[model samples]
Target: MLKTLSAYIGEYKKVSIKTPIYIIVEVLMEILIPFVTASIIDKGIQAGDMSKVLMYGGLMLVLAFISLFAGIQAGKYSALASTGFACNLREGIYSNIQNFAFSNIDKYSTAGLITRMTTDVTNVQNAYQMILRIAVRAPLMMICSMVMCFIINPTLSFIFLGALILLGFVLFFIIYKVTPIFTEGFAKYDDLNASVQENVTGIRVVKAFVREDHENKKFSKAAGNLYKIFVKAESWLAFNNPIMMFVIYGSIIALSWFAAHFITDGTMTTGNLTSMFCYVMSMMMSLMMLSMIFVMVSMSVASARRIAEVLNEKADITNPENPVMEVPDGRIDFNHVNFTYKKDSDKDALEDIDIHINAGETIGIIGGTGCGKSSFVNLISRLYDVKDGSVCVGGIDVRDYDLETLRNEVSVVLQKNVLFSGTILDNLRWGDENASEEDCIEACRQACADEFIERMPDKYNTWIEQGGSNVSGGQRQRLCIARALLKHPKVLILDDSTSAVDTATDAKIKKAFATKIPGTTKIIVSQRISSIQDADRILVLENGCVSGFDTHENLVENNKVYREIYEVQTQGGGDFDEAGE
Candidate 1:
């Protein structure tokens, strides 16, 4: 985990190295002040030499300023290194997530990824700053102060050693008791975030259903779970301060009592006793800082692991070396194709599927719910690889083709189309970044979206709300189709994309496809029988098997499933929307 995380600390390594150097210099300077003060007290004040007093006092003041300067520099560098690390870490995780295949993404929830990117990263950043600064400074200060104490008075130094051992035991117990609770607490944050994300995104549905109180209660339960775990962890850690204070003051009193006897016997001078008092505070304070560092590290250990999970995750899909760079045409062949969304699942989404589609042949797919309509089309783009057999495009296995080239050639307008927050033109340009304004308008016209675009006050320049919520469902679908049309792909798969549009507009879109792009293979997955009755061929899917593949007229006479569906829509028994999954 450490090795993986350290890779993101690029360019900030110089600042990370410089921060510790500054801290070490600062600790060394701070440790010398007590020695200088002891000289001023014993050799100058006790001897009636004003010159020695002035010289050592002035030198101490100068050393104090130097220490302060080093401390400020250390703080500056620490901030730079930590914030830069956080920026790089977030960027790396986001970039890696972008490359993850659909199967890999299924392993993690949306809320879990958001928590790792946000709360988890913040915890690690704070812990990293403490490690570079206090973690470095405290140990060096403790060691230097302990050495000075032994040199001043060995007999009294044992009190500090004993106190150190006692505090170590106390802190160890606190850390051990709190770590597991904190680890569990961070996981609870994922649930809490999930609750919030779900509520906010679906707030309209929640309010429409009049479930505000129910949602509030649900959120309260998730929050309460996190609160209870934190209270338990903190209650254990609360022992640290009291135990440290007791050890600190107890050792001070014992050292003062033993040093008084030595001072009276002339074995220890008053100046050395005073310096030991200062060293005692220095050493014990260092231990206190270390305790705080331990607490922070314990809180961040869970976060570090979560972050490493994202960073270390390898994409399940990648382009093979020496790959076929171009798809010759949109002739797709699925031979004995089998796919399961989960690797260990017993059920396959698409099973034993064998089909051969010719270029420029328009195929219509009709199926009941859970009949793998979307899954069948998804394989052509290599969205999810087939679990068995080969899915060939242009006579080449999808795995042998460059991923970008294949995906670009196979444009998909999914059922749940999403539009980003941008102008209408901006969203349309996502289909082809360099497409000219005229090319965009032409695609919109073919998709029947140009009518609405010209109706809006801002036309193509109108700002679209996130998820295209500003437009009607039909408008959103039309805009998405236009965006896909801009790709000019060899194969276009519309997975129930025209469900929201009226029958007239749907007919117009099909007409445009037949007339404008006659050579491109079109796969239309629709619920309506009228939509596919004129297709060159219609595929009937049922229970993960191909029930029929033939012209519509033949299917109505021969295929049982297709005949029933056609009768339902034609005989007023049902409509397209009522038949969908």
Candidate 2:
């Protein structure tokens, strides 16, 4: 836990030498508090010296004021440190997630990632604050108080030591038992977050199916279990403070009885006895700080371990040292590419398939569900590594290019369209951060999104809610297309991205692609026959294997699956404009 804490401290630029200075002043002020009280009783009251009483009491007040000032300063430092650390932590985690390969993200569900970012990060931040504040100061106070007590009366202080040791045993037992419970709590929190996120995102379907009551019951079960865990943990922690308070008071009573004999025997003066009482009070206050710190530190340790696991993950997709920065010429070659998602699996997602795409050509991939249509395109973008062969973009292996340069050159509009929280223009600018206003408008025009966008109250400046919640499905698809269009990439991938748009809109978008993007190499992956019917070349896939590759006319004539799909889709009254010059 301390190691994790040390690592977190290193991340924050705000953590400075001044933090420890405040902590030292705070502890010193705490140590002097009882000594001043002992002096008030011993020197002032016993000798009837009112002036001395005022002098020592006035010094105590000064120390108390300084302690208050130090506490506020310490709080400022702690707040600044925790805030800066949390921001750094969030940014670092986001950067890691941003660069993670598509296959890596696929390994974890979207809902799980959301929980990690929000709930998991919050836990880490809480731990950070505790480590900087209570964790540092509490132990120091306990040690200082004990040393002061030892100077006052070693015999009475011996009694204080035994009680503290007994208290430590109690604390250890509580922490050991509760740590596992905290781990379980965080797990259940993940499940709870996943369920809530899924339900809210799919609320339309849930309402259509009338699953509100069912979902409510399910949520109640999760929330109720969380409540039970929280209550159990809180109750366990709550019991410790009262028990510690009782122990401290009991020790004071026992010490007073032991000291009575010495006072009467004249072995100890009344002033000496007074100082011992002051020591007893100091011990109690120190124990109180110790108990709270122990509880918090235990909770923090569990959270730190969870955060460490995320930070320590190694990247599976990273650039090679001395990598080639090749400019893509739009000439792509796939040489016997055999790929599989599994590490030790014999089955390949794509078998020894070989193909070549020249510059300024259109390619269409037609396949059944799970026939590796997305996977095949994903490899060209280096979203996954191929085992058997190489994917060359611009006549050089994709891995030979820097990841940022390669990715910038290849734009992909995935099946699941994502729009961030911003204005329409802002989201479109994601493709080209420095895109001009005219650039966005032109991209929108080409993508067939300008018609509705111009209808929006703010047009290009219209606010798009997170995940494009405010936009229609087809609108989001067009916006995604516009985003890709803004980049002017060498290769553009439309992976079943036109599914949301109607056939007429799809045709318009397709025509715009042919005219507006003159030299861009295009790969269109679709299950619909109409979407890819006009492609210069079409590849048919069956059960993860490329059944055939040719023109749409040739594929329909030869491949039975392609023929059946065409016959069904066209017969369903969907007019396909497959006219050629």
Tell me, by TM-score, which candidate is best: 1
List the candidate 1 regions with Cα displacement exceeding 4 Å: 576-581
- List the lowest-lDDT window of 10 residues for candidate 2: 572-581
- Alpha-carbon TM-score of each model against the true structure: 0.98, 0.92
Instruction: Give all candidates' CA lDDT scores.
Output: 0.93, 0.80
Residue-level lDDT tens digits of model 1 in 504-581: 999999999999999899999999988788889999999788999999999999999999989888898556455455
Across residues 344-456, which tens digit of lDDT does each residue of candidate 2 receive?
88789999779888887888988777788888899988989998889999899988888988888889999889999999989999999999999999999999999999899
Residue 129, model 2: lDDT of: 70
Structural RMSD, model 2? 3.5
TM-score of 2: 0.92
